[model samples]
Target: MIDSIIFLIKTAFKNVFKNWLLTIASISILSVCLIVLGSVMLIVGNINLFIDEIGDESQIVLFIEEDLTVDEITQISDRLHSISNIGNINYKSNSMILEEYKESLGEDAWLFEDLDAETFRNSFVFNIKDLEKYDQTIYEVEKIDGIAKIKERRDVIERIVDIKDVLTFLSFWIVMIFVIISMVIITNSVKVSVYAKKQEIWLMKYVGATDAFIEAPYFMEGIIIGLTAGFIAIISQIYVYNNVLSPILSDLGFINPLNIDSVMSVIVIGFLVAGAIIGTIGSAYPVKKYLNV
Candidate 1:
């Protein structure tokens, strides 16, 4: 078995170099596909990170009637808790609200120094778990008796949600298209490799080589192409991300670009698996077509 495996590997390597042009072409196409896909993954990852950061800061501020007693406030809090999508609800007294306003002003806090702390409205801040159900949550909260006014900037959230949805949709279609193109390119490359070795393949078959024995070398050849392409793609993506995208995003401060180190394992494993599969399938097609035993 070891001898057979060694022989197959040797044959695959020989064929790979012998048909160096096809191998190079296959690697180039596969690498390009991986680069495009990896770039999209980075963009989508950062967008998601930005959205989550914004969401953490986003809140629904329900300014309740200032005169409500402790029991009334507790009842309102209980009602908010009953909502399934509400992740967190914090009650802020009038004094707390005054303190927040003062902090926001910093040195200008003295401008409103004469005003009484009791003048500010008591409120509850609601952190929503699911943004899609925000409107329904708002409607339910509005029906509560103590809520004087509901203050939330849904415009920004809505716009971000729309953009995220569009990006996700587009990325899916783009990935599918690139995968198809990669597979097609690899398939043609393998077909050319097989055509180059047709006489040798026929001679092996005439001498009673089993189907698996005949196909093993081609499978190895495909895997070699895929693995090489995958590594090239990963290296190219890391370089581009650090050199081109990171600088721009770092200046923005609000957007957190993903660290290549953090996501490297996932990228490497994902590409390796995808590359192997593409190569195996690409080589398999020609085997079925040409090696009819």
Candidate 2:
């Protein structure tokens, strides 16, 4: 068993280096495919993170009726509290709204100097626990008597949610297509390697060599190629994300880009696993088709 293992290891390395150009070509293609796929996953991951942050902080703005009494306001507050999925319920008086507007205006606060705080409506701001029930909650909130107008940040959130699914689906298919192409390239590479050693393989087989002995070396070759490709792809991805993409995203205040550590952790495992599977399958196919004799 030990001898067989040692022989397979030696032969696999020999085959890999003997046809260095083809092996390199296969690895390069696989690395490029992996890099593209990793980028897509990272982009989608950050987008989803940003969306979740926004969604978590999202709120409904309920403008109160100017003529509603204190009792009516209390009733409205109670009604809001009674609703399911309600989180924090904050009451913003007209004065508070005006103050916020002034703070936002900064130098332009002078333009609003003549306008009274009473000109702004008093409102209730509500955070919700579940985004999926947003429409239903909006409907319920609208039916309340003391509400003069209703505004929600849900429109933007809903649009982002829709876009998220579309992007994920499209990116998945795109990555899958690239993976298939890479696998085909690797398969051909394996076939070439196998053909180069056909006479040796036949001689060994004739001399009572087991099928496993002949096939083990090719399997190891595939694994080595996959591991090398995966490592290279990860390094390339990190460089591009940190030096190229992250700097640009950092300048954009609205975007919340993912930290490198988190992304690396996921990509490392993902790349290694994907590379191993693709390598194993690619190597197995040619061996099954051509070496079965």
Candidate 3:
């Protein structure tokens, strides 16, 4: 068993090296496919992060009419609290709103010197627990008598959600196309290696060598090609994400990019597993035809 294993390993390495050009081509194509997959995954992950961040900060502001009495305001607050979808609710008085506006103005505070605190209506700022209920929540809030206006960025959130869906769809088809291409390339490469050693394969079969023994080397060759490509893809992905993409994204104040360290293990494991599966399928496909001999 040890000798057979050694022979299989040696034969696999020899076949891979013997067809170096085809091996290189196969690796190149597979690497490009993996890189594309990795990039799409990273983008999707960051977009998800951004979406969650937006969700956390997403708030509906209800501007209350100045004429409402304290009891009316309390009633409105109680009504808002009763809503199943509402998360945290905070009341901001007119004076507090004026103070926020002043802080926003910064050096241009003089421009708003004549602005009276009463110009700003008291408002309740609250987050929604479920974005899907956004419209219904708004309808409920609008029905309240004390509210003068309802402010929200529903349009923006909807657009972001749409973008995420589109990207996910595109990435799925794109990765599938690349996977098919990679398999075809690997199949052809393995076919060449098998053809090159046909005479030896025939003799081994004539000596009663099992089909499994004969097919093992080619199978290993495919795995080696896939692993090489996967390793290269991983390296390229790390360099580009850490040295290029991460830096650019980190500079953007609003984007909270995921740390590469947090996800590195996942990426590595995913790529390696994907590579092994692709390699096994690609090699096994062509080797079957030769098995009948």
Candidate 4:
């Protein structure tokens, strides 16, 4: 058994070294594929991170009754704070709103000089646990005693929610494309390697070697190739982050540092698995087709 193991090891190495160019070519192609796939994965993750950052403070603004006294509005704000899914509640009076308008518009804010914060009405800004419940929660708020009307951010929230949906769809399509292309490229590489060794495989079969014995070395080669590609992909991703992604994320101001790490982990695992399976399947087809004799 030990001798057989030694032979297999020796043979695997010999094959790997003998087909140096072929091995390099196959691994290189897989490396390139993994890098591109990794980039797509990173982009997907960044989009998700951006969406989540925006969602952390997701809220609905309720417009309070203009005639409601200060005490009444305070009671409503206090009641909202007691809700299960509610986070923090920020109550801004109409006067405060007008001040913010002036600050925002600068010199042009003078156009609204005729209006005071009272014109804007007091709004209750409260967050919810789940964004999907926003509309229902707003409906509930409208029923409150001091709420004359509710001005939930229907337009902006809908746009943000739509972006999340688009990002999720994009992730699926991107993953599908990665799988297909990775399979094609890796399988083609394995096929080429097998083609070059077709005569050797036939000789092994003629010498009474079982299929398992004949396939062992190639399988190991595939794993090694996969590991190599994974390493390359990871290094490439890190380089991209340090030299590209990080700088861009920094400019964006809310980048989560773990995003790149998550992306690299996914890509490395993805490439390794892809490489192993494609190598195994690709080798199987050629061996079955050309070595059965």
User: How does each model score on TM-score?
Assistant: 0.84, 0.76, 0.73, 0.68
**Model 2 lowest lDDT segment of ten:** 126-135
- Count steric clashes of candidate 2: 0
All-Cα superposition RMSD per candidate: 3.0, 4.3, 4.5, 4.9
**Residue 162's lDDT in candidate 4:** 84
Which candidate gets the maximum lDDT versus the true structure?
Answer: 3
Candidates 2 and 3, the one with greater TM-score: 2
* lDDT by residue (tens digit), candidate 1, 56-112: 689888999978889999999999999998876898988888888889999999987
For model 3, residues 77-189, the per-residue Cα lDDT tens digits are: 99999888888899999999888888998999888888898888899999877665677878888888888888989897687668767878988998899899999999999
The better-scoring model by TM-score among 1 and 4 is 1
lDDT of each: 0.86, 0.86, 0.88, 0.70
Best-matching candidate per TM-score: 1
| Tens-digit lDDT track of model 4 for 228-259 | 76777678777876788767776877766454
Candidate 2 residue-wise lDDT, 1-293, digit = tens: 79878888999999889889999998999999998898888777777777767776777789999988999999999999999887789999999998898899999998887889889999999876666677888888888897899888767868866887798899989998988988898888889999999999899898998888889888888888888899999899899888877777768887778887876778898888888888888899998898874
lDDT score, candidate 3: 0.88
- The Cα error of candidate 1 at residue 88, in Å, is 5.8
Error of 1 at 149 (Å): 4.6
Q: After superposition, how far is residue 218 of candidate 2 from its true place, in Å?
A: 1.4
RMSD of 4: 4.9
Candidate closer to the true structure by TM-score (higher is better), 1 or 2: 1
